[model samples]
Target: MSTIVSARGLTKKYGDFTAVDGIDFEIQEGECFGFLGPNGAGKTTTVRMIHCVSPVTAGTLTVDGSAAGVDNRALKKKTGVIPQEITLDIDLTVYENLLVFARFFDIPKREAKARIAELLKFVELETRRDSKIDQLSTGMKRRLLVARALLNKPRIIIADEPTTGLDPQARHLIWQRLRQLKAQGVTLILTTQYMEEAQQLCDRLVVMHQGKILKAGDPRGLIESEIGKDVVEIRMPPDRDEELLARLGPLACGHERVGDTLYFYCRDGIGLWKALVDLDLPNTVHRPATLEDVFLKLTGRSLIE
Candidate 1:
């Protein structure tokens, strides 16, 4: 796959505070590339530059062979954005909301009508087409947002926290639609705080922190590299951590104590489990290491705010 978006030493600043600081990354065509981070971590800012709405403070940023800038109308024409916020007009029916958006792309009334019908069905909001935006459920509204983004038949789609307030069933439905679009060869750029969302949709991703890239790789690869195959949690008192580590630390690759739990990351979990059982420790859990483990390990377990 060819590079669809590339950034070298990219920087974004508002006044003296920098949001993105000299980060470099590349996005491949027809892949779901994700930007994962905590709140105010510049994931949104980086994608904003990619979509050409926010200007780069300094750096070489290019999308589809053209330099990215706020004035790049040609680039904007082929890019679709599913914003984090629900920006639909409450007074308009779902169909009218899409109609107004389609007009922005200069799509003719006849073509817009045809495209809107197709998109509504694709998002499973066909029955809600004439329903007012305010009358729809949160899931229905989010699905409508997905349809609105596709009006331009874009080559690239940016989804920023697309399933913020959605339930499991609703979120999965959106995921299916996104996967369908990607299978059709649309390049997907996603920014999200949900680790499951990233693992589900992204073929590859970059984890951002304080305007910098901490790690970049496929979800499973990152999990394996940063955290081993299994994790053991012993919810003993903090004072007993040293005693427990002394007994089981050699079997695990690494250990950390957070709150009342001592976490053991290991490739050889069987040995670790056996050791814990021999010790007859209570409140012990051995589980598979996941993307969330890698995320917290890199980003720190503390609240970002």
Candidate 2:
């Protein structure tokens, strides 16, 4: 796979505060990469630098082998961005919004018209192409944003918090479009707080904290390697956390205590369950491990927190 993006010692600082501490990574063509972290963990900062919308404070970066100092316009043309905030113009119709984006690429009028129609259909917004921006549903607006981004037919797409706030069905609709993009071999970089969104879409991911990477790999690989194969949660009194930790030795290969919850991680959750039952340890329930448990294990808290 060819490298589509690369960064070495990438840093961004403001006065005395550092937003992105020196970090380095590469993204290859035709893969969905993710930056997974809580708010203020510098995921957006990284995306801004990649999009060339924010200057790097230090270090070297390149897109498609184009140096940071060269061909930024050419680079931007191949990159499509969906910012954390909505940027649609309320007065423009759905089709018109995309036509404006195509014009920025200096696409010819006749070709731009064809492209806009195709993009609208790709995002499932074809039926509502004439709807005024304000009259469209939230999901429709998001679809339009996606259509606008693809107006130039970019090779790489950057989505920041794509499903931040929407009903479950709306979110799923957006997810569907993203999957379609991947199936067509478009390289994508997604930053999302929603664990399920990242898990379902990303081929590999980096979990960031305090402007640093805590772990990196495919979601399931990171979970199975950083953590173990299984996790068992036992709810107990907040003050009894320490006691639960001590008693977990008979049931867990490794354990962690966060507030009133005791987490047991091991290769076999059912074995731990049988031990807990044999020892009469007070466990509420035993279940399979998930990305949520992996996040809590590494961060010592919930993803939202």
Winning model by TM-score: 1
| Candidate RMSDs in order | 0.8, 2.2
**Candidate 2 residue-wise lDDT, 251-293, digit = tens:** 6678776677777887778777776676675646776666766
Each candidate's clash count: 0, 0
Those runs of model 2 whose alpha carbons end farther than 4 Å from true positions after fitting are: 69-71, 238-247, 279-283, 302-305
Tens-digit lDDT track of model 1 for 88-178: 9898999999999899899999999999999999998888879988899999989999999999999999999999999999999999999
Worst 10 residues of 2 by lDDT: 296-305
Name every residue pair that clashes in candidate 1: none
Backbone steric clashes in candidate 2, count: 0
